[model samples]
Target: MAMAIRYERPYSHSAHWARRLAWVGLVVFLAAALSHRFGPLTTPHFLVLAGSGAALSALAVVLSGIGFIRLWRVGARGGRAAFVALLLAALPLGVAGYAAYAYFTRPMIYDVTTDPFASPPWLKVPVAHQDFLARPPVTLQDREIQATAYPELTGRRYEGALDRVLEGVRKVADEQGIVFTGEAGLENVISDLEDLAVKPDGDTGGESAITVVPVPSARPLEEGFLPRIGGPSDVLLQGEWRSLVFGFRFDVSIRLREEEETALVDMRVASRYGPHDLGLGAAFAERYLKALDAQLLGIAGN
Candidate 1:
């Protein structure tokens, strides 16, 4: 007798929910991107939404993968739809993955400072971040990074009076929309280094105010003054970056020393945060210095 084979009908599946979930992921990702790119969505809000959307899309991809496998193994209906679901789900998942990687791997610094060791210390306030209390004043890594990245930002000597230099510094800062919070007069501007040093926490004896002081140089300038005094101005800058109203506070010190026929101007800008500044600090310094040049040279507006 010949053996007979029986053919069974394949299991039917519309896979409607799986396909819809994939489209939902894509839609959510696009919404998040649009909100972040041009939005009422704040940075924090966008971050939360983007992160959540990515995770949901990843889940959808997994589900779609399972659906695809089922359709293939049992010869079920909607195989094409299952494959489409998988492809669509992947788009958001990949974007979210990249973003997470960048956030964690990239440096934690967004602010920059020029003279970290000599920059004014922040007061013991709730708004102060961890950067204000950095140990060793300036870190070796920060020095190396700045030296390599911005070698041209060193202090320069200009011929002018101390008062003029101070005024120029203020004017340039104002033009750049940087707000000064505190002012140290000429006397305090040339104070001793030890007195102006940022002390350890809980000292309570040190002045909380930002001080202007002379950059202590080993060799005295015979043609000019021994040490040039710099006025320290605490500035808070507010701007928008990536759907967020970003604010960063730093110090700009303008040093002026009088000579027979000229004065030297040394300007330095340093921020409390480090590792990276997104070039904001460097750009600010460059712009202010250029404007000060125009002002000191009396060529501004001409």
Candidate 2:
């Protein structure tokens, strides 16, 4: 009698869904990231969710990698899923790593002021009962940094009458969408001094036409990274580039002092908190000055 040949059935790979699990983890992480960026939840809550999701996704990636290697050895399936999952996992990982690097490498100061020598004073009266963020006093170190980083930020001189110079400043600020504060309007009050037989274009002790603009508030984010959003952000990076929450605000000011046939316009932008401005102050001043220069040229032509 001949014995029948016996063939054992091949076994399926254990944890074949490892890669699928990684995919799910990645999805969770992406959702968390979106929520952190655009969702109405506060910073702390967003950080927690993001941190948890990243951890889970990372673990899943590791497990999926191991599973893929094992499956290959065993001649099992799911090679494609494993590879795709690994690739997907890397996207957020790379982003997080880059953000960490940028955060760590960011400037030490959070406040940016245009006039480092004599920064225009910020006067936001504290709201009653509600704690208000106050503008940071300019420090020597901050001035030094501003001077070094923004050498071209010095005031520019223009030859024009007081009203004309003031109009130029106003137009520039308006174009930039900066609203003038009451203090800035006080320049109009001092415009009477122009009639003292004093030259409005000379530096013969004529009051400056000032324009104060409170920086616009940031919109509720729809989706984006921290640095990509509004200036003077409440999110601050501290030790090891960790998050330090501090609600803050920013404002910009233009002071145009009249001298004989010349007006010296100085711009100052500052945050209510932090010492480093991420170089935003310098950028704002540069743009404003350029716009003012163009506006004055237009006026001269007219």
Per-candidate TM-scores read 0.44, 0.53
Please give the CA lDDT of all the candidate structures.
0.52, 0.52
> In order, how many clashes per candidate?
11, 16
lDDT of 2 by residue, 1-302 (tens): 99999865333333345556556667766776665445554434544555565665676677677766667677556666667667766765665566467446555555444445455444442221212322354587877876776777676666555566676777777776566653443333233333323334655555644322211112222243322211221111111111222222345655655544455566666543344444554666688777877777765312
Local accuracy of candidate 1 as per-residue lDDT tens digits, 1-302? 99999877454343545677778778876787676566654434554666676766676666666666677788666667767777887777776676557446544344344443343333221132443334334465765666666766554444434454556666776777665554334552322234333456677775564333323222222454332223343222222122122344445544444443234455555543433344656767776767766765651111
Which segments of candidate 2 are over 4 A away from where they belong?
Answer: 1-106, 125-137, 185-249, 272-275
User: How close to the true structure is residue 87 of candidate 1, measured as C-alpha lDDT?
Assistant: 80
Model 1 poorest 10 in a row by lDDT: 235-244
- The whole-model C-alpha lDDT of candidate 2 against the native structure comes to 0.52
